[model samples]
Target: MENEVQRPLADFPVNIWEDIFTSFSNSDLGSDKLKEKHITLKETVKESFMASRANPIENIKFIDTLCRLGVSYHFEKDITDKLEKSFDCLDFNQKIRQERCDLYTVGIVFQVFRQFGFKLSADVFNKFKDEDGKFKAHLVADARGMLTLYEAAQWSTPGEDILDEALAFSNAHLEEISSRSSPHLAIRIKNALKHPFHKGISRIETRKFISYYEAEEKCDSTLLEFAKIDFNLLQMLYRHELACVTRWLPEAPNGIPDSMKHLYRTIIDFYDKLEDELEKQGRSGCGFHLKKSLKSTSNGYMQEVNWLKKDYTAKFDEYKENAILSSAYYAIMGVTFVGMGEVAKLDAFEWLSSHPKIRTAAEIICRFTDDITSYDFEHKREHVATGIDCYMKQFCVSKELAVHGLFNIVSNAWKELNQELMRPHSFLFPFLMRILNLSRIIDVVYRYEDAYTHPEFLKEHIVSLLIENIPI
Candidate 1:
C-alpha cells in the first residue's frame, strides 16, 4: 500500500495523480490508455476466467476477478488494504493534489467530457469486501468498475477476458445495489455498443441505465453512430495508408504531360502567374483585356503554351498515380461538407431560434462567402470537376450533369441559410447581426474612400485590423 499511495506522486504530482484517477472513473481511458493496459491485463484476465470456469467459486468476489484483470501494484488485495488505511497520510500533500487536478482538468477539457452534458454524481460503487478484517472490497470494486467502463468504451476489440471479468464484478453485487445508475456511464455504454463487435451486449442491461436526466434525447446516440462510422472510414483509410498524403496536392492543373518535364515546370510557373494576376484583380479591377507581350509573340512562348496544355492533359491522366484514393475521397468529402454549410447554418438557426447570437451567425455566413469570393472553394471544385468531367465527358450527361450536381449542393446551402434567417436560434442570430454591421462598415469605407489604394493608409489599417477601440 505504501508503494500504491506513492505511485501517483512518484510519476506525477499528487494533485495530478488524483485527476488521472478521476479519469479512470470518468471512463475515457479506453481511447487514450486501453492499448497500454491491454498487454498487462491480458494474462491476468485469462487466468481468472479460466480459474472461475474450473470451479464455481461461492464468494465469486470482484477482487478475485480483479486479481486476474491486471496488475496495478496496488491492485493486489494486501496493497489495496494498506493504501485505504493510509490514504489519510497522503492527504497531507495538498500541493501535489492541486497540481495533479489541474493537469487532469486540462485533459477533461481538451478531450473526454466535450460539449455540455450533465455528469451524474453518485457513489458509483457500493459493495465492499472485508479481507482479514480490513475494508478492501469496495476500493477494488470501485476501481474495477471504472476500469471496465474505460476499457469497454476504448478497446479496439470488444469481448476480451477483461470485459468478462468486469461483467463478473458487476454481477457479484447485483443483489445488494443501492446507488442509482449513472447517466454518463449509460451514454458510454451506448456509444461502445455502436461498434459492430459490441452490438451483441445485452440491450436490456444497457436500458436499465436510462434515467430522467439524459439531456438531448437520441442526439448523443446519433452522434455516437456517426462518429463510429467516420472512425471506421478512418481506420480503413489508415489500413490503405492513403490517409496521409492528399493535403499538399495542387487544386488545379491545366493538363500537363509528364513526358515533357520542361513543359510541366512551365505550366506550374504559369499558374503561379495566374495566382498573382488574381491577387492583382482583387486589388483593382474584376476583369482585364489581354495584351500580347513581346515574349508571348515569340515562337518559344507559343511552344511553351502548347506544351502547358498538353502537360495539363497528361497530369490529369496521371492523377490516380500521383494521388491516393483516400485523399481524393476526403477531398470530395470536404467539398460535400462545405456544401452542407448552408444546411448546418439552417440547423444552427433552428437551434438558436430568433435569439441567435448575430455575431456568430454573421461570421459563419462570412466564412462561407469568403471561401467562394476568394476562389479557394472554386479551386478545389475545379480540380475535382476536371477529373470527373474527364471520365464522364464521353457520356452526353457529362458537363451538364456535373454542373447540376454542384449547383444542387450550393442550392441546398442557400435554402438552409434562408430557413435560418426565417427562424434563427442558439447563438446564430446575435452573431450574424454583429458580423453584418462590421462587414457593412468595411464595405462602405472601401466604396467611398480611395484610402485602401494609398500605401500609408493601407499599412496603418492592416496594423490595426483586429484591434478594437474599446477595452474589453
Candidate 2:
C-alpha cells in the first residue's frame, strides 16, 4: 500500500464540551435515599391505582397521569389490566356518542387505547362535528380539550382523513389559544407545539410534565412527589452509567482506530455495566451477545469507510443492509435488554439478530431520514455515500424526485413498524417498545433536520432531563 498524505477529513466540531458531563453529580440526587422514597411512592401510586379501578372516570384520569408522569412503565400490567377492563365496560363508540362525554375525556380515551395498541376508530370524533362535517368551531375555546384532541390526532394512520382534519383544526386553534393563555398553560402548549407528546421521549416528557402537572390546581401531591423522586433517582442511575463510560474509555483496546475508539468504548462499557446489573438480577449472557452485536455494528462503519475509499455508491439494497447495522439501533435494544428475564432477553437477541422487519423498518426510517436531511452538509465534506446518493444514482432520478421517493420509503417503513407493533411478536412488548422508541427518536431528530449531528436541537431536552430539577 502506498503511504497516503495526511489530511483533515472533515471540519465537524465537537458541539458538547467535556465539562458538561464533569459537572454532573448524584450527591444532591441522593440515590439511596431517593430509592427508598421511590419505593414508598410506588406503593402509594399502586394503591391509588387499585382504588381508582372501581371508578371508571377516576381510573382513566389516573392512567393518564401515570403516562404523563412517565412512570407508566413501572405499572404496565396495572395500566393494561385497567384499560382492558375499562374498554370492556365502556364501549368507546357508545361513550363518544353520549351527550355527557366531553372532548377531553374522549380524546384521552382514544389516545390511551391507541397508545397501548388497542385499535380505535378515528370516526369517534364524528359526533363533535357539525353539518359541514368539520370539528365544531366553538370547541376552540376549550384549550385543554383542543390540546387533547390535537394529541389524539397524532395517532392517525394512512387514509384517516378525519384525524388529518382534526390535527389541522386543533393545531390552528391551539396556536391561537396558546398565545393568549395563562403562563402555565402556555408553557405546556408551547412544549406540545414544539414536540407532540406522542413523539417525545418518555423520560424527557415525564420530566417536563412533572413541572406542568405540579402547576395544576388539582395535582396530587403524592403523584407529583413520586414523579420527582423517581426522575431524580433515574437521573442518578444515568449519571453513574455515563461515569462508567468515562472511566472505561481510556482503557479501551489500543487496536481500535482513534476515530472510532470513543464510540466503541462508550457502547462496550455501557453493555458491560448493564450486563453486570442484569447478572445481579439473575439475567446473564445478554451482555456478551450485545457486545458481539456491537462488533457487528462497528463492522458496518468499517464497510462504509471501505466503500468511501473506493469512491463507491452502493446499490440501494446494499446500502440498506449496511445502514441497518450502522444505525445504532442494536445499541438501543441492548441497553433495554438489561434486567429482562432470561427468556425475554434471549428472545429479544434472537429477534434482533435476524434483522426482523420491525427493526429493519426502524433502521431504514432512521438512515433515510438522516441522509435526506443531512446530505447537503455531508456532501460539502469527505463523506461516505449516503442513501440519497445511492438512490439517486441507482434510479437515475433528480435530487427532488429522489428525496420524494426517499420520503415514500420512510413512510412505508413507518407502516411496517406500525403493523409489526399492532400484533403479538416473538419478543416481549417492552422489548418491542425499545424499537418503537428508537423510531420515535428519529422522528424528532430528523423532523426537519439532523438534530443529533447538530446538538443545539437537543440541548433543551438534555437540560430539562438532566441539568435541571423540577421544583417541588
Q: Which candidate is the best by lDDT?
A: 2
- Looking at model 2, report the run of 10 residues with the lowest lDDT sum: 338-347
For 1-472, candidate 2 gives per-residue lDDT tens digits of 4885554366565868465665555574465666788899999988878873444766777788899998887888888887777666656457666878889988888888878876677777988899998889889888888999998887776667888799889987788899889999999988888888887788898888988998899989998899888887777667666666676766766565555677678767867887797677666666677888789789899999899889899988899889888877776666666535665555567667777777788888888888889888788877888888888889999889889999988877875676566545555677778888888888888877777778877888788776666654
208-256, model 1: which lDDT tens digit per residue?
2222112435433322232222223323333233212232233445466
> Would you estimate the TM-scores of all the predictions?
0.18, 0.83
Q: For model 2, what is the alpha-carbon lDDT of residue 216?
A: 91
User: Candidate 1, which ten residues in sequence have the lowest lDDT sum?
Assistant: 114-123
